[model samples]
Target: MDLEATKNLSASHTIGNYILKSKLGESSFSTVWKAENKITGGEVAAKQVYLSKLNKNLRNCLDCELNFLSSVNHPNIIRLLDVFEINLGMMFTEALLLDMVLRKSIWSSSASIMLEILKQTVIYMLSVSIIFHFCKSEYLQSQDECCVFLVLEFCSGGNLASYLQQHGRVQEKIAKRFTQQMGDGLKILQSHHIIHRDLKPENILLSGKESDVVLKIADFGLSRVLPDNHVETVCGSPFYMAPEVLQFQRYDCKVDMWSVGVILFELLNGYPPFRGRTNFQNIKSSSCLPFSQHILPGLHPDCVDICSRLLSANPVQRLSFDEFYHHKFLRIKGVGKYHGQ
Candidate 1:
């Protein structure tokens, strides 16, 4: 849309006591904004989807995200506060208000403090077993649809890749802590039968600042809920691709484990397990990360073993995501979250 058209779209968009403040991010079919609840005086991340694109697979993706996030209460998973469609009159004729209060995010205010407050809120919500099931009060006809908006808790910190670039390779202690949390997150997903197909560092978000940071798995657009034992989908980033995925063979959740291995390798060695001058070379090469303790001087033997098993070329040989949590390395509680990064 032209700037003038974009302004026209913005002007007519509003919900009960919530005013759009700033744009947070956007995809081809959606634009997510940082909105403020005027009545509650609290901030939140709002995702607005173009109603024009909500047909077939695009609609299915949004529905999947809503279902998965609503059932998930893990600290490592992103939270969905609300979902509703705004339509008709090119003004605020309908409003779906949510009670969940989110704190200010990185763009506009005190981020670290906001995260601490949100952590407490998450604990309370989970402890009390407060869950909201997805519901649609009304569905507009395909012709009258305007937009679908989703409210989510803000993840203020940058992605793990950005953090890695700023701080270099993190020491083993911090790396293990992060690895353990990532495993825990995956374990939760396994229990829920959801596969986060995209498991690269960019989808792994750093939730807080400095020593108190938390890692969360974000961006579920490519994720799928597979109840069957396996699925045949040729997707995900090539650098983190499991052998089967690269070969276009049938695969399942184990592919996520392979990505985890690649992530850990990059964190420790400042590079991914797979690297090449060309994408084709990276995709076709069978070269695996050397688990030699000599090459990874500072890492413990157990850590090296864990990484090797996860990056196994044979999917059947790779450690399952749950197995990583029980690994001896993760059992050793690290000092704290990213002391430097």
Candidate 2:
């Protein structure tokens, strides 16, 4: 893998039968590109992972993601298309092909408009979680470098991180819409015994079609399935880390709720709930970010309560999926509001 040039393979080249057209995104180990499948005349996203340049043991982050993708199928989850391991020069690199989702402009001038957008995004996440419950593994192809590739749904809408950063702060109604969707997504994952170890706005993606504003949860690099006993890995973002996760204790799906709190806080406050001057400060004090009480006064009372419970210091004390589903925040009773309507 050409470290410098491979940064945005999505824009530069195609993996196999796909014709690369534009760059979608890039991370330290992988790059996502938008392309057209020459065979079917369909659009797809290609994620190029540079495994040879990573740890000699072959960091299985991509593999883990592939494994999860193979096992789970969801409408909100990006679908894996194919895997490519072509000769870069002297060695081979890994790339995952996926469907691309289109992005739309976020309008925050009005609560009603934002509410509609957030509602659609959450609905998309709910679809993904629903599909995850009955997932089946399928073989695409294997890489020579011991890495794997997956094909997923194409969401042209892009990721939530850029959306939040661009919009700064979302209105209360809009934030609640997003929170419901995110919470529903997590509830689905938890129901199926899947844990989105890393739950952040960046990992959440949007759909391309304007009529279908589906928000997908993408990038399972740090995700893991909890065994019957549960997992003890100390992974996830510093800002969204649960207190128990920070303490290096055995944790379960509740960690995702902790992340949900952080995301909700950011949606309302424009920044992470636990922001510090430096990375060290963020990690050191992140576990104790006072739930939305002080930072989110303008938010609805029920919304604040939900965020507080999700951000509880004790994982066990956090709200469960049932409680979250029936929370007052999601229970909009009037016609002007959204809920069962």
Candidate 3:
């Protein structure tokens, strides 16, 4: 019912038809757990959102995530299997009962008795109102205090961030392979007119074994569908965010291309091209993308071209999604013929 209670929840807790086995990850307002279906015995990642903790923007993101994931069936996107909510009223009611029991001794006086009656009456009316509202509306009110769970496909190989940490600066061949897979995923996003405002290595997941990993675009918490192809919301990780977004300018899907460029650069150089203590400093630092001198001369010209074009500070100069997907680096001969482990 509250933050503390939510934190105390652990393995063995059953929600819907799945049993939470362990925590996969968490954020300020949500937690992801590795769960198993009781009926089918299939493993899934259950993302639980605390409805009371969401603000308007976050609620919109939640709606977007649910809507996008539910309608799409792409190999490079996370699959949503089911969604359900568990009401916290029972827990709240139990706590209220305990509080009343503790205060029973103070109700001996006539005045205290009248006060207790009034409190109970108010509680009864509030409970009735909550029940009626829940029945009438599809969206849960903050007062409802329920946990919404999104059961998704579990990627056991972990995210690209961890992979990079384990094996810093992968081979150029590997980087190209990964980029191609990311392009495949982005094509799906582009077709739907969705802007994945938060695109970074940490948000890309690797499924399958190490030798045959499949990259999936994930974490749509900051994503939105843009029919007009532009948005003004300046939200994203600073290191991988596009300069236009950093400068508070309206941007389009090209912003994601900027992030992909950053990822490609990181995969080849072991770090992002820019660094700053703040967004202002970050934008200033991004005027020049620093390709490692030792590695630059060795990289393919096509690779260098794509990386530079995608990281252009001027959105007008940046590569569009179609261009990036069809660039020579991703489509050239022998690009997908990596044999190294």
TM-score each candidate. 0.74, 0.71, 0.83
- The residue ranges of model 1 lying beyond 4 angstroms of the native Cα positions read 1-17, 92-145, 277-279, 286-295, 333-341
**Model 3: per-residue Cα lDDT over 104-214, one tens digit each:** 636656777766766885687578667756674545456566778899999998999999999988888888999999999989888888889899988999899899999
- Per-residue lDDT of 121-190 in model 1, one digit per residue for the tens? 6675554332211322335334444566778777778689899989888887778888887987888788
Question: For every model in order, what is the number of clashing pairs?
Answer: 0, 24, 0
* Candidate structures ordered by TM-score, highest first: 3, 1, 2
Query: Model 2: which ten-residue window has the lowest total lDDT?
Result: 93-102
Model 1 poorest ten-residue lDDT run: 89-98
Residue 84 in candidate 2 has what lDDT? 55
lDDT of 2: 0.65
> Which whole-number lDDT from 0 to 100 does residue 28 have in model 1?
66
Off by over 4 Å in 2: 1-12, 53-64, 83-147, 208-212, 278-280, 283-289, 333-341
| Clash count in backbone of candidate 1 | 0
Question: For residues 1-341, what per-residue lDDT tens digits would candidate 2 score against the true structure?
Answer: 33455443334355567777876766666666777887898877766676654552235555556666666566667667676554342222112211111123233566676666656766765664455335422211121222223445567677888888778877777677677767666665665667788889889987756344566777777766667886777777777787777777888878887888788878877887777775567655654555544564445567778877877777778987678778887777522432212
Best by lDDT: 3
TM-score of candidate 3 against the unseen true structure: 0.83
